[model samples]
Target: MAAVRDSSFERQAPEADAEELARRHLVQPWPYAGSIGSEARGLIGSGDGIYVTDGEGRRLIDGPAGMWCVNAGHRREELAGVMYEQAMRLSYNTPWYTMNEPSAVLAERIAAHAPGDLSHVFFTTGGSSAVESALRFMQFYNNVRGWPEKKLLLSRGGAYHGSTYLSASLNGRPRDRDWMDVADGLVVKLSSPDPFRRPEGMTVEAFADQLVDEFAETVARIGADKIGAFVGEPVQASGGVIVPPPGYLPRIREICRDNDILYVSDEVVTGFGRLGEIFASQDVFGIDPDIITFAKGVTSGYFPLGGMLVSERLLADLRRSNHPDAMYAHGLTYTSHPVGCAVALANLDLLEGGILDHARAVAPYFQERLKTLEELPLVGEVRGVGLMACVECVADRESNDPLKLDYEVGKRIDAHCHSLGLLVRPLIHMCVMSPPLIISRSQIDDMVAILREGISRTMDDLATEGVWQG
Candidate 1:
């Protein structure tokens, strides 16, 4: 395939000067103290389809799909056109007292795709705020019901909710909270349902049973009356794309329902065709959550927008509450922005048109292709569902223990893959691959081929450096 370029995105400054400026001025997310404001990442010049050209003019596959949000692919004219037209018609509207037509329409459209009675939407700036809104709403709901003490949240070991205070508190990745402080008293963590890390010699079904029992035991010990909600990713996106064992989510949902604890599915990564569905709660997992927080692919990352879909039953309960005059008291300045909603509408059209069908048809092949990487000695496992997957490296095949070198293995693989024309999201010892849903079978082959070579080269480097032998 020929390289596609967008002249409109031409760099204003030379590559060397641009890097220098960024190192001096820009503060990137997840910065380390050693290089906090003095670092510059690879410069991506422009993107089209599943490919992006870096500042060095190397065309590479967008392996992580712009942090797993660019589902409709890069440089989509439909999404771009809608944003421009919407901005021209009505760019900014304060959603506090007033509202806009696009938000209402988008909400209605989203509600149609949502499960159960999730008929209402509360827009936010992004995934972090979306989750923040859901958690805060849970607090307000309990308070309004005269149970202010019932505010403890339940999260899992391998989850990634968001970056806001409360939401970040729920993050379960190893390093996410090492240097950060969270509301420790307000959250309860459960075991990660990662079948890969399940106890040795245990069947997957037994592992699932163990997980469910743990939840039940935790609830019984802590008293369900004190719990407000249980938030989890259907697939645990950043947690190495951890797909729980079969029948786990439905059982957990039932437990949440029986205990009157709300189940909040954070679909920031799984929603919008990444899992071959608009919402994976009911359609894919056979569970209807009380609230579903989503962002990322809603507008294909064209604009920053996210929101939570609330069940009608929850809203009705609030309506019937004695505190009829109570206010939830949560809102963002950019809540229900007209342009974001309009872009989302167009993005929905693209998905419903045929992109969703394409994603569904190609997902199995995508998974199968990536799974082949497990043949490599460095790969401990390659597991995922739909188009999302993870390649986890281990020190040895027997124990599946990670390299003591921390995330260096993943970074080395990413470095090699970047040179081989593919971008990769290195999450510590794992390399996550959630390419754009628009990727073709040929593209998947290319991606996996490059990845295999990258990992092989990384193994070679490790052996040369006396890190490990296979």
Candidate 2:
């Protein structure tokens, strides 16, 4: 393979024709299939640092870090070089019966950064697979231990585990499951631990106590023997970066431990420096989960790699039990691919070198700057920690009443931001931003300036178009 140094994408034809070609060939993810060609979402041609060049030769700041995975930024020669070398040496290998050096090395490095006794690793192709594998492993563990009744999962409302069947069943996002059929009765959901969305007039501390008490009551009602695992994101990402009350995670961990339920942390969006650490469950949140599913930033979007970290105590129990002969019987064809692992290793070097520290030092500034948006009448709340944040738009801030569903407010904000040379990830009525961990303070200012202007323009549009009566 040869390297292409060209930055701008060469136009094959007019922009309209190019977009039409995309709609014809590409089936966008999480999309309304009927509206494939109705809108023009620019094609990303090339990326460098925190910027991506669109198909029409326009450069824009990457606000969501390529779906919250590109933590080390784009076009990193070191990662590219590692991938090229590993592919040339050993592009493919069957992990079913054989193991590779890169995978072993990467797993060791990951375990080193992981918390507590999470000493074992199982790699997957991406976040979804990682989550699927963890759930399967939990089921297998229960089955082997003669507790087949422990098959139900306990996840919170507004959590997103993955898109696979079992994992998707654990997803609590209303829209995500509205049209799809999930494995019924497999999961019992608790209320989301969103402080911003707490019952009106309830204090944050009281809200946290209520959330924990709810979990305790749910366990008592369902019987802990019927539950296999309690899965949750430290900070719910796709459900809109909902940060919980301070003591929420630790209290949940205690309850799970008391009830003999596996506590699984879904770090698909928060791992690998997104939260200024390799893993945030223990270091930042003060609890050691029995299982941790991670993806996205492992290779910094240079390669597809995700994994599940297993605690030593759980494996010890499995080894000592009568199920010593039991087999987990789970893996993927691309599990531990050498190229992905090699790229991940290089990405880790970048993170551990200095980027993690930079993120920690700059996160407060980022949060502080975005909080100013709350002054805008169209903005309801600003909530986040570390590099990730969400700005939710509302029609009434006093009541947090959202705009009408058909208003497409988030899309309008995204469009305006794109015009101003910034790319933001829109989740219905909210804008999500998790820029590259390498982004500078000055770059953050530019990104926030564009976001503010975009929101302002959106407010004007909504008023002019009669979408906002006030």
Candidate 3:
């Protein structure tokens, strides 16, 4: 490999360790591995505000918010110190038959802070359990309503709820369903309410109308009387952070109401200040879901914790049904784990302070920086809200079609950024971003600078391979 004129090179050996591990041990790692993001090595450490230090002393700004879960950033001493205190005193207690102080306190905080009739909180170890609990509640609600036939659930076209069987099926992703068949029955996919992907000459209103029509068709096919629930993210994070068009959420709310389906918001990623709102569903979209799944920011990712917000009607039905006595048959061993709850409470206190408001205030500035990516060569679309953002890479600007570089091109760009000390997470063909809410203007510029360099070189590198065309 002598010097090739004007040819930018990308090192492949760096991610070989990750590939080997995947080939030898793991089976599924969606939006993280495979041809998309496997080249970057996995890390074991992080810091406050805007950086993650790998075990090997590699540092990069985590723009994707720790799988879009960590809104409060990592390595916050408050979250850590509180957890230590809790671990010293009453670290574990069963939420099932027994309760703990921290868990009760955290539940009160969640209920008070949560929107709408979401006054009841059921803690889970993580987002997966929260989503699973939401699904179970759908069936239970239908049974309680005396309509067991309404078992079908509808989800958005590309939302990522979780990875467990029920949650995966509830999600709207092709990659997630590649191996697992829909054995769970009645999980229907509907067109998402994305403004960017709207059909030609269609207004956001019309596109949303089409989306509602698709849901109506699904319900018709399944019979509205048989539909149980409709679940989706307010911003559709895992699906390239496709922010739904204006009036889209209200329309979906209408559709759910028209058909009498429970509306579930998978806010596992958009909850907290990620969207500059407490919950994207209510603050951004102006619609409140019957139930919402939450994790990541709830505990600031200090300890694994996710929970489901329940409405009054649902809670009353459950209480009236004697569901606890009947054993609804759901819960994790670490459900309402005391340490996680304590950290969550501490994290909540930290988030509730003016820091969240500061993040919200500067959201427009962060969004402006993200939009600057449009001037780059390979970058096509920049979608974001609050601190969350995404840049969809494309080979040609005219059609907005993907380069189909798959893993190779994405890894090269990501590695190039890493080498420059900026960390970015590539999801599918799009680069996702969710830097900690505490990120400053300078760090945002730093992150964007590296990304610009990486994207600029990707075109040059791909051209050398004769794969990219105008």
Write candidate 1's Cα lDDT for 1-470 as tens digits: 11323466455888898899989999989999999899999998889999999998999999999989999999988888788788778999888789999999999999999999999999998999999999999999999999999999999998999999999999998699999999889999999999989999999999999999999999999999999999999999999999999999999999999999999999999999999999999999999999999999999999999999999998898999999999999998999999999999999999999999999999999999998998999899999999999999988789888877545789999999999999999987899999999999999999999999999999999889886887
Better of 2 and 3 by lDDT: 2
Q: Which residue segments of model 3 deviate by more than 4 Å? A: 1-40, 320-325, 405-408
Q: How high is each candidate's TM-score?
A: 0.98, 0.96, 0.89
Q: How close is candidate 1 to the true structure, as a TM-score?
A: 0.98
Q: What's the CA error at residue 141 for candidate 1, in Å? A: 0.7
Root-mean-square deviation (CA) per prediction: 2.6, 2.2, 7.8
- Highest-scoring model, lDDT: 1
Better of 2 and 3 by TM-score: 2
Candidate 2, residues 339-390, lDDT tens digits: the string is 9999999999999999999999999999999999888889999999999999
Lowest summed lDDT window (length 10), candidate 3:
1-10
Q: CA shift at 51, candidate 3, in angstroms?
A: 1.1
Where does the lowest 10-residue lDDT sum fall in candidate 2?
Answer: 1-10
Clashes of each: 0, 0, 3
TM-score order of candidates, top first: 1, 2, 3
What range of 10 consecutive residues in model 1 has the weakest lDDT sum? 1-10
Q: What is the lDDT of residue 244 in candidate 3?
A: 80
